[model samples]
Target chain A: MGEFELIRQYFMPLARLHGSSSVIVGPGDDCAVQRVPPGSDLVFSIDTLVEGVHFPVGYRPDYLGWRTLAVAASDLAAMGAEPSCFTLALTLPEADELWLRDFSLGLGNAAESFGLTLAGGDTTRGPLTLSVQVHGVVEQGGAIRRSGARAGDLVVVSGSLGDAGAALDYLPAQEDLDADDSAAADKQFVLERYHHPQPRLDLGKALRQFATAAIDVSDGLLADLNHILEASNVGASIELARIPVSPALVRLKGSAATDYALHSGDDYELCATISEASWVGAPAWLKQQLTVVGEIEPVSGLRLDGSAVVSGSEATGFDHFRRKA
Target chain B: MGEFELIRQYFMPLARLHGSSSVIVGPGDDCAVQRVPPGSDLVFSIDTLVEGVHFPVGYRPDYLGWRTLAVAASDLAAMGAEPSCFTLALTLPEADELWLRDFSLGLGNAAESFGLTLAGGDTTRGPLTLSVQVHGVVEQGGAIRRSGARAGDLVVVSGSLGDAGAALDYLPAQEDLDADDSAAADKQFVLERYHHPQPRLDLGKALRQFATAAIDVSDGLLADLNHILEASNVGASIELARIPVSPALVRLKGSAATDYALHSGDDYELCATISEASWVGAPAWLKQQLTVVGEIEPVSGLRLDGSAVVSGSEATGFDHFRRKA
Candidate 1:
């Protein structure tokens, strides 16, 4: 099929969506249209996913498509902006028809799931890399930034942390697993978490109402939340015991892949702060959907139940520069 | 260096630009804010450059940085939109401080050169890939889209064509070229064409006031303009003698690689159409800046000096998917 038809068929149907009203024009032109609310601000974020580094070396096209968009969307989720349009820049070694078909299906599904439209993007020659720049809107000066956390705020999380990291560890890349160990048994949870972690848009919008500070846990809770703490000049105390460790997580706890839980990263869940006073009035859904794992304090350094964590020591999160080729 | 600090140090300064009145928020959030002019629309486009695909394997980081953003800005120019804000999604194998320092310098240089601000972006682990999403504003629905050309429109181009593709043929992908080859000596032109293309934003704005259709010479003069003819359902006739060929390009004609210049692609200049009646009255700068390349006709297909130009046949321009990995 022709390039124009291919995009129209697979991506256009994904436009005219929830984040579309402000987008006066969506795709099919030199550019897409998005109107800033009369007095509101615009928030922008971009994310890139390389095939082998960001995902399993042999991951399927479908999951690659979903994970790519999901990761970028989560950035918009971190800021309290209404998810709008996104541009996708895809580079691939070659255009395998089957891979394109499956990838488009997964991309279409995720786009439908998030109510986001494909605005525009470029398809180019290169190692497979997916880059998405997400656009969202915040009412005039209403965005919750990393700098807004106060000393006495409660650090909250939307959903359990480290599920994606667990999923990654649980996925086959765990070479340390006994050669004879049965991977089939652990594949389901890991696959779901790895492939389709939702971009909490609804929860993100909710956070604008309750969150004073927020960030998406892309580089692990400790590292990403540390961003907020640093931006706000505050420290955080996590009840290592209370940081929601799911039953799925318990399976990995014995694995010291606890590093996976502690910092293997890529959860894409929101980590936020609300004043201890405001936490009292947080919506019932906020409590049900998000876990209160820590509290913001006036001190400087991360701690687990009052003990120093990573104090003048090595970090336990993704290191873009340190990874071995 | 800390990831957050590195970003704040190099990136925050780029966003310090005071953009158009439509920019409610410039950068530093999840997205950017742009005011759609009363009756105007938001024009969007994205472009990606991969380490080895768009450039040589060991191409300079600084030039890549500048070129990446400049090429994407050309899309806005193609639509007759004023340059606005842009978001970057930079994927690198490693974040070497020196590499990033030069990269940011080039990025900052381009932002300043183009009067755009770097708003927000994602940095992730991957084979090197750079994605830029540029947003521009067209006067309330005045964008000159590819589908707007019609029979009897005067086809035009903003600058001399083929220099880029010709330059590409002679560009040294490895070490410096030998002075013995005349074509190789032309590497300077090709490198400039490839690494430092002008986005034509001013010419684009002028065309919006005088043209009926527009497109960037990304694919090739013949092929890209064909996209306009095909989309507008009109044919075009060109005086082959009138097709603008730069000094460097004239030397390369008649060689097999001439086809590459005619069809090799990656020149991000503007090719547009003006109605025959509006053609003579076109704004002064547009008349000064662009050349009449051809004229549109009631029939379908393209002609050069009354002979049909071979299009949609063999290789016309760069096709990411069709290329060998």
Candidate 2:
């Protein structure tokens, strides 16, 4: 199919089903026009995922589509903004009808899940790469920034970490797992975490009233938290035992689970700093999903269990260029 | 350099220099936050350019930087929106410092020239590709849509066409042109048109109150105008001799200039349909940049000098997938 046919067959339905009323003009135009509600600030972010570099080559199209949008939407979650709309610029080697259908299905499902409208996009021929730019809105002056962490703030994270990182080990043999086998369930759990990690949008919205600083833990906990420290001119001391990990991760990696939680990336969980009083007063349901793993300090470095860890050093998370070379 | 350091050394300065006051938070944040003024609608579009596909391999990075942003921003212009801010997602095989510096310099110059602020972005490792998503603002309910053209509306286009497309013939030997040669200056002119095609922002803004519909000519005048016709459910009759062609293009292609003017892409000029009264009353400066090429009709297909030209059949413009393979 041609680019226009592909868009009409696969993406137009997705847009019609999940498109928001705020979208004045959706897909079939030079640009998508949207109405940002009064008293709101617009939040914008762009992320690119390339085959082999960001994901395994020939990865499942549905999962790839879901993961791509989920990854980009995490930035909006980090800013405590409500899900709004997104544009996708896709470069593919060919126009495979089946791939487009499955990918659009996955993307549409995720859009429905996140309440994001499909605004506009471009499709071109090239080596496979997907660039998604997400737009969201928060009440004016209500955005949480990385530069707001104060000394004595509690460093917190949503849900559990490390499962997605640990899942990398089983990815190559993922298709080999038998559904009826005893260990298959745990493997499937981690695989799901890797392929469909949910953005902590709800947790972030709750933290808007309480959190001092926030970031999504895409580059592992240590590295992403250090960003907040550097931006806010503060330090952090993380208790190694307090870091949370899933049962599936522990079952797969055993003693290495803690290491994964500390240094591996792509969890998509929100890492935030909040004052003790605010954390204590936060809703019971909100506190149930969070774990206080560290505390901000006056000094300007990162520490684990009272031992200093240099920023951007050995324990720092994924750097696309450095890690590759 | 690693991705973070690369961003800091190159892109951060661009953000600081062209950063808009509306941008509450710029680069380094998970998502850039910006305040939209009350009573305005947001307009968005995304475009991707891939090395060896969209442009030749080893293309100049500075021109690539400027062209990428300009191509995306043309959508905003077509929507008659004021320039605002944009996010870039860049994928490269390696981190070349000199390329980054020159590319950022060119990008910064374009940002300053177009009144766009650098917001946030992502850098990843892959085959070289750049995706730009631009955001602009228009008065509430003021965006001109492609579906609004009336049967009597005059088909108008801004500036000349086909110089950029014809420039491709001289691209491989672009560096061989000597200043003292007689034909060198004309070759250089078309090359410049190819490298730095301006988005008709001023003309588009003025078109808001007068135009019934508008689109930017990225995929040949016939193909793009066909889009407006299809959306508006109307037909058009063009005067073959009235199509505009640049002097530089005419000098190079002579008798073939009209074909390039009608069917070439990447000129990035605005095409709109307006009532005859509005066309007559338009400001002289605006009128000077535009030419009356045709008129919309109640029929359902395009015609050239009363001869039928089937839409999406023979005269259709560039299709990335279809044209490639």
Candidate 3:
């Protein structure tokens, strides 16, 4: 199929699934025209995933599609914005019909799950890469920011922390896990967590009412949480025992499980800070997703169990061009 | 330098150059948040350029950066939307500080020229690729779209056509042309057109007042005009003698000058359908940019000089995957 044919056959169908009321002109135009609800702010973000560096070459197309869209959507969640639509800029080495079909199916599933629609996009021939830009709407003055955290705010996180990180550490051992029947389920669980991270959109929306600051845990809990601290000009003291680690992660890497929770990245869960009063007043369901792990302080340094956090490969999370070489 | 340092030094300055009032939160965040002016619609588009496939493998980084932003911005112009802000998703093989500095300078220059700012973006290590997503705003019902073309409307284009296309065709001859001093200035003009074709922003905005339909001539005049025809379910009769050809383009292609005007892509000029009454009322400065070339017809085929348009290798504009084997 040609680029136009591919877009028509695969992408165009995805656009038709949800007829968004806000979109004046959707796909098949030079630009997708959408209306931002009056009294609302437009929230937008772009993320690119490249072959080899971001994901292994020849990775499953469906998973790759889901991951690219999900990761970009996570940024909207961090801002407490309701997703409106997204545009994709895809680069592929060639046009493969079967691969394109599966990828679009996965992309459609993501759009459906997130309550957003495919607006418009560009497709080009090149090395395998995907860039997704998401647009969302937030009520005026309701959007969350990393710079809103106060010195005495309580830092919290949603769900488990290290499963995705642990999955990355043990991905190479998947082939051998099948031989050991006992490890199969855990291996599948961890791998799925890594491949399909659930962005905390609902939790973030709830946080808009109570949280002082917010960020998505993309580059490990420590690294992402530190972003909130640095932006807000404060410090944090994380309780060593409070970081949530899933059973699958602990089973996969036993004694070093907490290390992954602290430093390993790709956890799309959210990290936020709230006042003590808001934490106490938060509804039960909302509280269940959040676990208090630390408290913000006046000084500017990260600490664990009252000691400065200074030792570990995972301490700083992954940096693209500056990763240890 | 680390990704953070690189952004602080290069990207952050671009964001600070012109403080955009619509931007609620700009850069240094999970997502950039901005407000769409009340009673306006948000218009957005994304475009990706890959090394080798989109341009030469070792193309000038500064020109590459400018071209990437300018081409994406052209989509906004086609929609008759005012440029607001843009995000960059850049993938690179390595962190070459010098290359990054020049590229960011070009990107910053484009942002300043278009009156937009760097909102937010992602950077990673991989094969060289740049994906830019531009945001614009237009009155709720003011966006010019391809589907709005009507029969009897005059097909008009802004500025000269095919300069960029001719430049691409004659680029290899540039080195040889330098030996012939007479061709030097034209060579430079054509090369600049190829590398940094201006987006007709003012023309597009003006088109909202009089154009029934509009599209940027990214893919040759004939091919892009066909898009408006197909979308609006109309045909066109293009006057061969009326097509505007620049002196440099005519000088370079000689006998094939008309062919390039008819079929060359990437001119980045505005091709729009305007009612005759609106054309007559248009201001002289705006009228100077527009040249009448054809008329929309009730039939369902494109023609030139009373004959069907066929028998040309460059008949269709470029398609990503279908251009060539």
Candidate 4:
């Protein structure tokens, strides 16, 4: 099918199913017109995933569709913004029918899960790359920023980390592994964690009233937290023992799980700093998913287990260009 | 340099130079936060241009940078929205410092010309591709859309058409031709037209009060106007002789200039439909830049010079995927 036909057959329906009322005009226009709620600020971020670089070649289209949107939405989750809408720019080598179908299905599922409207997008012919620009709304001046953390703020993280990083080792073996194999269940758990990592939108919204600073952990805990520290001009001391890791990841990597939790990327969990008073007063439901792993300090560096570590070091996290070296 | 350093060196400065007051949080965060003025609606669009597919390999990075942002901003013009901000997703095979410096210079220049803030974006390693998402604001309920054209509306277009299309022939020869060559000046003009086609932002914003429908002429006159026709459920009768063409293009293509004007893409001019009364009542400044090339009709197909033309026929315009076949 041609570009228009592909969009009509696969994407138009998805837009209709997931489009929000805020979308004054949806697809089929040069621009999508949307109404930002009165008194709300807008937050947006763009993310691109290139095949063979961001993901393995010939990865499942559905999982890719899910992964791309989830990854982009995680930025909104970090900003404590309510999900609103997004535009996708997808470049592909060919107009593959089945691929487009499955991709749109997964994308639609993600749009529904994240409560975003499909505003508009551009599809072009090229090497496979997907760029999603997600927009969200936050109360005026209520967006939690990385620069807001102050000394004495408690650094916390939502959900477990490092499963996606640990899952990397099992990706190539996924097809050959038997379902009844002893490691199959553990492998499946980590693989699912890799493929379908959830963006903490609800938790982010909840933190808006309480958190002093926030960031999404796509570049590993140490690297991403360094962003918060650098922006706020503060430091953090993370208790390595308090870092949470999924049982599946621990089972798969054992002693290496803590390292992955600290330095591996693509977890999509929100790492935020909250005032000690606010953390203590935060609702039980909110605190239940969060683990207080550290505290912000006046010193301007990252400390782990009482030792200062260099930020942006090779051991800190994944760097697209650095990986080449 | 890693992605962070590259962004800090090249992109962050551009963001600061073009950053609008509305941008609450700029680059270096998980998301950029911006305040949408109350009583206004948001307009956004995304466009991707891939190397080799969209432009020639080894094309001037600066021109590519300007062209990419201009092409994306054209969508905002089509919606009759005031330029606001944009995010860029840039992918590259390698970190070429000189290429990045020149590209960012061109991009920053365009951002200034179009009054757009560099919000935030992602950079990744891959084949070269740029996906720009532009956001704008329009008065509440005042966005001009393709669906609003009426049968009696007069079709109008701003500036000249087909120069960019005609310029394609000069691209490969740009380097070989001597500066003193007879056709050098004309080739230079057309090439500039291709590389720096102006988005009709002022024209679009002026049309917000009077235009029944509007679209940017990207995919040739016929193909793009047909979009307005289809969306508004109306037909059009275009006077072939009335379609404006640049003297440079006419000199280049002779009698074939008319065909190029009708069938070539990437003009970045605004094609709008307004009531006959509104067209007459429009200010002289607005009328000067526009040519009355056609009129909307009760029928549901396109007619050029009293003859019906198939909208998506191969002769009409360019289709990225269709070109492969």
Provide interface RMSD per model, one decimal.
Answer: 3.0, 1.6, 2.4, 1.5
Q: What would the DockQ be for model 3?
A: 0.70
Candidate 3 iRMSD, 1 decimal = 2.4
For model 3, the superposed segments whose C-alpha errors exceed 4 Å read A172-179, A310-315, A322-325, B170-179, B310-315
State how far residue B321 of model 4 sits from its true place (Å). 1.2
CA RMSD of each candidate after superposition: 3.5, 1.6, 2.2, 1.7
The residue-by-residue lDDT of candidate 1 on B21-137, one tens digit each, is 456555554445454555556677888877666776767778877888888888888888887778888887766788888888888888888877766677777787888888777
Docking class of 1: medium
Candidate 1 local lDDT, residue B215: 85
DockQ of each: 0.54, 0.77, 0.70, 0.78
Q: Estimate every model's Cα lDDT from 0 to 1.
A: 0.73, 0.88, 0.85, 0.88
Q: Would candidate 3 be rated incorrect, acceptable, medium or high by CAPRI criteria?
A: medium
Clashes of 3: 3
lDDT of 4 by residue, A1-325 (tens): 5678788888887567643457888889999988888888888899999998788899899999999999999999999999888888999998899999999988989988999878899999999999998989998888999999999999999999898887888887867878778878988888888899899999999999999999999989998999899899999899999999988888888989999998776779999999999988999999998999999999999999899998553447577875631
The regions of model 2 sitting more than 4 angstroms off are A178-182, A313-315, B178-181, B313-315
| Candidate 1 fraction of reference contacts recovered | 0.71
What is the docking quality class of candidate 2?
medium
Per-residue alpha-carbon lDDT of candidate 2 for residues B1-325, written as tens digits (9 for 90 to 100): 5678888899987677653457789998899987878999988899999888788889899998899989988998899999888888999888999999989988888887888888888999889999998888999999889999999999999888888888887888888887788778788988898899899887889899999999999988999999999999999999988999877778888889988878877779999999999988988988898999999999989899999887862358578886631
